[model samples]
Target: MISGLDPSGGAGIQADIQAVTALGCHPMPVLSCLTVQDTRNVYNATATDPEIIRQQLECLAADSPIHAIKTGALGNAAVVDVLVEFLAAHPDIPLIADPVIKAAGGGDLADEALIARMKERLFRHAEIITPNGIELTLLGGDEDETRAAHNLLEAGCQSVLATGGHGEGEEIINTLYSHDQEPLYFYIERIGGEYHGTGCTLAASIAAGRASGLSARASIAQAQNYVLRAIRHALKVGNGQPVPDRGIPWET
Candidate 1:
């Protein structure tokens, strides 16, 4: 996993780790950014040094046997460039890039340049890139949901999953697109309350499924179902966004 550390434990790398573990796969974490935030929006974020990022990834790659990689909040262009080097070193590993450009509570996570790097570098190389509505709007090439994913696929990513949570819809729509194939859409009833960290859970769950021997499509389905339960069992913490229940069984 690659992301900022969220002290509230409801989002970012902490959330990714919890979700991956809940799905029963060993999580290999890579810290890309550090932030101070609660269940609400982020307060402040500091991107980790590029050299330190490289060293940590080198250490992990040399010492461990990792199956799949999940990326979250990568801070800036330089950090993303460093991560891109790490990705090049492990071409065989499946990567899930969760493009977290901003916080749910209106805090900016990355600047325009960083987002551009992510769209061009990380998204293009990963097995899958999961972006919510707003990110899709920005990264989505022509500002159209359907077009955004096609643009991403054209950019060389193996697949893209665009979540509908932040869109204007009666029901949330998750559309999965791949190279040389038409997009397949999945619909889920929208949970009524404010929510956060569901994106981290969804991506990491997919990573866990991939690590556990499921293909990208199968893993996506399984991860969707699991996210439903996690949302259904969401617990309110800090009077802000609803925290997803990490205790839910992802295998179901």
Candidate 2:
């Protein structure tokens, strides 16, 4: 299930559904925030009522086995707490959370309270969290990404995969750190253009992989490979950013 919303279908739950469907998995969505946004940036976020959150989840549970869950943007602290409560109630489900702090066009989507809420509540429930370098620094403080992962693990998460998209280089490195093993580093040539819904795409792809019965590491590997291909075949949408041709065949 995806947590973020999109009016333009370029990001958030819409993009997540596209990615999940393309990867041959069923998508059940639960929105955390309904955002006014496009390829450019987010103007504002309106959170789903916390009380209604559990109702949607109950429906999702009744319908499917929901092999995996992917969350895109949790707009506020309250929504995050709701997520944590939901996870606590269903500890058996695996979750892939994309810790989105800022939009691609440089707009802040999460508030100050949002971060603290995640650490105190939601971080503990997630099976895997994907954060960018900026977020890593915020979560890690003075520690490195490796240290940050361990720190996050201490909070109760099983793994952390920090993405280095804002770095300067030809290659983009995404490092996965887990409590039970050494870090796994995956690399891909950085796609030069701005893209919409990439975080949603990657996280949903991971959920899809895991839903197909692949292990966590295997899911990350296949998801990484999938994102590279999606970027390579991306389509220019709107004036601001390229969106992956989510309809493209992602699995061979």
Candidate 3:
């Protein structure tokens, strides 16, 4: 299931839908927030009612057996609270969270209070959390990436995938950290030009892989390859940043 809905079809649940479908998984969308956005940036976002959120989740949970859950920009603390409680009741389902604190165009997505509560509650329930450099710093309240990842792991996430898109490097370095295993690094040549919604695509793809019964490690690897191909075929749909061509197949 997915929370955030993006009219742009560039990120949030829209992107999640495309990524999951591409990976041969059925998607069940549950909106926590709705946004007015294009390929450029988010103009405005409105939070869905917490009761409505619970209703949707309950309806889906009752009718269908959800394999995995992918969550994006939850609008406020109320939605976070509802989601946290719902996630707690379904502990075995893999949850992939893309910690979207800010948009690609530098728009503020979440407030300080929401972020804090998410770390305390939502993070503990996630199977794995995917955060870029800026988000990691904000969530961890520290500049050190390794330290921040460890902080998240200690907070309760089974694993953390710290993406390197915002970091300074000639080659992008994505790291996966788990409690009992050594850190695994995925190196990909940095694709030139800024693209929107890579994080959402990555997290959604990972969730899809997990839903298909792949282990976290295997899912991370598949997700990375999928995102890389999507980036390679990215489209300049609007005046601002290009969006990943999620409809394109990985092989072609």
Query: Candidate 1 or 3, higher TM-score?
Result: 3
User: Tens-digit lDDT track for model 2 on 137-234?
Assistant: 77766457677777888777778888876677899888898888888888888978667887788888888888888888888888878888888888
Model 3 sits at a Cα RMSD from the real structure of: 1.5
Weakest ten-residue segment in model 1 by summed lDDT: 164-173
Off by over 4 Å in 3: none
lDDT of 3 by residue, 7-39 (tens): 777788888888999988999888878888877
Q: Number of the top candidate by TM-score? A: 3
RMSD vs true structure, all candidates: 1.5, 1.7, 1.5
Q: TM-score of each candidate?
A: 0.94, 0.93, 0.95
lDDT of 1 at 246: 81
Off by over 4 Å in 1: 168-170
Candidate 1, 83-164: lDDT as tens digits: 8888898888898899888899989999999988987787767988999878887887677778877877777778889987
Task: Indicate whether candidate 2 or candidate 3 has the larger TM-score.
Answer: 3
Backbone clash pairs for candidate 3 read: none
| lDDT comparison, 1 vs 2, better candidate | 1
Q: With candidate 1 superimposed using the best TM-score fit, by how many Å does residue 118's alpha carbon deviate from the native?
A: 1.2
Superior candidate under lDDT, 1 versus 3:
3
